[model samples]
Target: MATDGIEAVFLETHNWGKSARFFQALGFELDFATDHSSGRLRNGQGAYVFIAEVPEDHKPGMQVVLTVPDAEAFRPGPDVEVVTPFEDTHFGTRQATVRDPDGRLWNLQAPAGN
Candidate 1:
């Protein structure tokens, strides 16, 4: 499957409200917000940012989300390492995590019903 491009940037924050405000101040308009736990924001054009509260035992970090034509059909080469198998998310997307050779984590995603 070919990658479409970056879908979104996922950020895990301890203080969701504060983090959302920080991004808003930077000119990212609020797209939709969930009860102070998570939300989606977009800048002019097509860039998007997704913020969510960090779960217990999870460290706050930035996750790069790449859009693929089909998440289930994306199979990394033998050199690439799979961190998490693809699974459907509550937000209506199938996602998987993989580690690059440089050890950076990337989230591969495909929109629902695609």
Candidate 2:
């Protein structure tokens, strides 16, 4: 269900810096960072997603983020499930999280300053 283009993808990790730097070394720019709950990393092109550490007791590696436009306007289509509601990020953008029937995660974000 790609609308415009690939926006952002998140990699959950216990170490945000390592992961963030890894992506940065690969040419991704750091747009913003947050430690409100879990740490987050955004790329230069406006693709900022998350990479959080899984709780020791919780299952690991079962989330994905699908980037979309106007996260607030995106409605649940078919098997989609809204996990996180659209809200302003500390980095100053509107973002939301959702899940597919398979439990795969998706993230929707509007353009910067939108």
Candidate 3:
């Protein structure tokens, strides 16, 4: 299925302050932050970044989310790995997880199904 392009990036960090500062230094503006030490940042009209602080034991990583017009209709190439079927997210989107040929996971997101 054709995608609308990248929507946002989900990142895990060890320190919220450091991570936030790093992005801010890169011209990203804070959108909002939560008590759980996570927030969204963006630069102009570009896609935003959601950063979450994780325990030291939890390795830091980033995941890219691709915007799809219809999550249910999104079908990848035959060789693509569908790690998870479309599911409703607490953040208000319908998402599915898929692994690239390199074994990295990418999130496919679309508007919540009516």
Candidate 4:
């Protein structure tokens, strides 16, 4: 009915490959890469995170992904807007995006196979 805490944290990097490797060296495992410029790493539990290449237009920063029972059910609040509709990822998860008042993007993800 309500969103739990953060499910993942998305880090925007100029070089996703290098950032992924750095996180791996810090004890994370490469979960999968959706494409050449973006991928995911996890600590082998529930601590999965993402590394994405920032476009020239989109300001880069931390994107806190929330755990909602159903990403499809999360309606955009009063001032928020749906940036990206829910879709299945290559790594096997459902994800969508929303924007806060300040325009910071937040990714909402449902567990893989849900």
TM-score of each: 0.82, 0.51, 0.91, 0.61
Q: What lDDT tens digits, residue by residue, belong to model 3 across residues 1-114?
A: 777999999999999989999999999999999999999999999789999999999999998999999887787889878899889999899998889889988898899982
Q: Report every candidate's CA lDDT.
A: 0.85, 0.62, 0.91, 0.80
Candidate 2 lDDT tens digits, 20-50 = 7777787766555665334555555565566
Please provide the root mean square deviation of candidate 3 (C-alpha atoms, Å). 1.4
Runs in model 3 with CA error above 4 Å? none
Clashing pairs in 3: none
User: Model 2, residue 26: what's the lDDT?
Assistant: 77
Of the two candidates 1 and 3, the one with more favorable TM-score, higher being better, is 3
**Sorted by TM-score, highest first, which candidate order results?**
3, 1, 4, 2
lDDT of 1 by residue, 1-114 (tens): 667888889889988889989999999999999985999999986759999998768889887888888766776788879899788898788888889889888888987765
Candidate 1 lDDT trough over 10 residues, lowest sum: 68-77
Give the least accurate 10-residue stretch of model 4, judged by summed lDDT. Answer: 71-80
Candidates 3 and 4 compared: the better one by lDDT is 3
Model 1 gets an lDDT of 0.85
TM-score of 1: 0.82
RMSD to truth, every model? 2.3, 4.7, 1.4, 4.0
Instruction: Provide the lowest-lDDT 10-residue window in model 2.
Output: 59-68
| Runs off by more than 4 Å, candidate 1 | 55-58
The clash tally of candidate 1 reads 0
